[model samples]
Target: MVPERRRLLSRRWFYLLLLLPGLLFALPLAEEDLNAIRSVTDFYGQRAGKRMQAWRELIQRGKQQQWDEKRALTEVNRFFNQMKFLSDVVLWGKNDYWASPMEFIGAGGGDCEDYSIAKYFSLLELGLNDEKLRMVYVKSLTYQQFHMVVAYYPTPAAIPLILDNIDVAIKPATQRKDLVPVFSFNGSHLWLMKERGQGQLAGSSSRLTLWNDLRSRFSSEKLKRPKLNLDD
Candidate 1:
């Protein structure tokens, strides 16, 4: 190969090399758990058809992307949002039930929070930075109801990208004028989203009863693959 072509190829390989450790760091899931997820999704695909196929494809896509953040976010967002938007009342007979990624895809239906939660974890599994991702609580002026969506901040000060089940297209927070952000959280810290870079620490995430419960369930489902985070 030409010297310039060789240098370019070397840089590409170097970047992929750097991506490897982060991918391992991001996926705390156990081998058995990953296998179990694969098996269950396989069964769903065979028996339930399209819904199950979507789940399987999501897993495959995550693995194939090899820690490409932009592609991972776009694919994961698209995968879960495609599911039918059924309320927790209709799906779980409760006003609110935070379904794990497995449970959400298994049922093939869920509300807005479910979509955001599933997308967050799936992106994490694909090695996207957890710091860049948040589950945002918002009030939907259009529907006049409390809602949830995933927000991706490429930089600390960049306008967040909104990943919503209700909207098929990914949009910047500025464009989504109809929805107002109240607060945001992830596996780490909960923030009082009053202004940019001015988030006050709310409290230990354990205070979020349902969020704590959901993370516990995720740990169990993943066969106790080491606690991700429980406190600051």
Candidate 2:
């Protein structure tokens, strides 16, 4: 009887050992997933500071230039254009490429995507409706790897005007098929792969599950990191 009891105990221990391997494998994957989400959150949170500054600048620029919709877009274009192409190149290569507008303004520099994001939020502050704007990720005809730009859609199904670092002219989206749209997102929603979808289908996904985490990081506390002279 004692030997049978001992055999049963041994089998219990073997089963427990089998469970350990699965737990070990799952632990790292869980951490990696969490880290990826955290990275996105960190990116947006850092930009919050720059976003605020950009908005303030926009307000001043509007007052100075008698801001209207067309002028606002032009002024935004001009502001980004002044940075030239080099900034965009550097920003793209850096693993820490772009920050939120708040972080970007505080840092004083960012890649093309950063400029686009800044302008998007600035337009929002200026009372541009969310439906009219999208931050689009695209493939550049000339450059390798993914690139980002803003597409302003004045109405649903209307062609969008592309704001690009490579060119100053704001052209229609259809004019450039070189830019195969990977995804389009606005301030409130991230559209997977395309812009059109039902409202009920908009928010359900593990992909966008990181948004709340990203949003929380945008609080003022995160923006208080000691400012660096990003111009350098």
Candidate 3:
């Protein structure tokens, strides 16, 4: 039923009804999301051509599969994993940096957290409810390092399927014995993942400076699109 209702919502209607007219700030305002894509392209200059093409493909693909959550998840995960896995130190010369989806794509590579963040927003743009998706930070027991991945819950009680760049295959959280989830966050809320199932609120996600900065920039920026010619 949840999926069915989600399917009933058209992408155009979603942008017009939910986004344009000050209805609810449900998903980081569509304009900001679109602008981020442009901003990243502008920053990288010469290197952004490929990223721009990928961006077009991503958006076009999302429109094509907007109603199908499973297909959208599979494709977006695949799209981002193709990027090289570079650490924050190597990519941005920082110990830790939370990149916007466009920034992740613009650079052509990023760390685990960047992959998760980019996938999370891609899913959001594809019309998956924010409540059903999360960016989970986990401790990899195998590597003994902190890692991040996207988690999708079909229902509140159902097990989440992990979308990871490392594996390129979506697997249930229970099946991934190597990853011990520490916490999860979406646009609106944060959670502390427990051993039992699901998780509880940890705190406001606004506490994360990089996250706040990204969101702030997204909200303020504007993107310019090419003019459409109907008569041509």
- Report every candidate's CA lDDT: 0.70, 0.57, 0.70
Candidate with the larger lDDT of 1 and 2: 1
Cα lDDT of model 1 overall? 0.70
Query: What TM-score fits each model?
Result: 0.73, 0.60, 0.75
In candidate 3, which residue ranges exceed 4 Å CA deviation?
Answer: 1-42, 65-67, 221-232
* Local accuracy of candidate 1 as per-residue lDDT tens digits, 121-219: 888877778889889888999999999999998987788888998887998888898887777888887887775332677966566888998998888
- Candidate 2 structure lDDT: 0.57
Candidate 2, TM-score vs. the true structure? 0.60
User: Best by TM-score, which number?
Assistant: 3
For candidate 2, write residues 146-227 as lDDT tens digits.
Answer: 8888888777767788887776788887777667677767766666565322112244332443334434544432442323
RMSD of each: 13.4, 21.6, 12.6
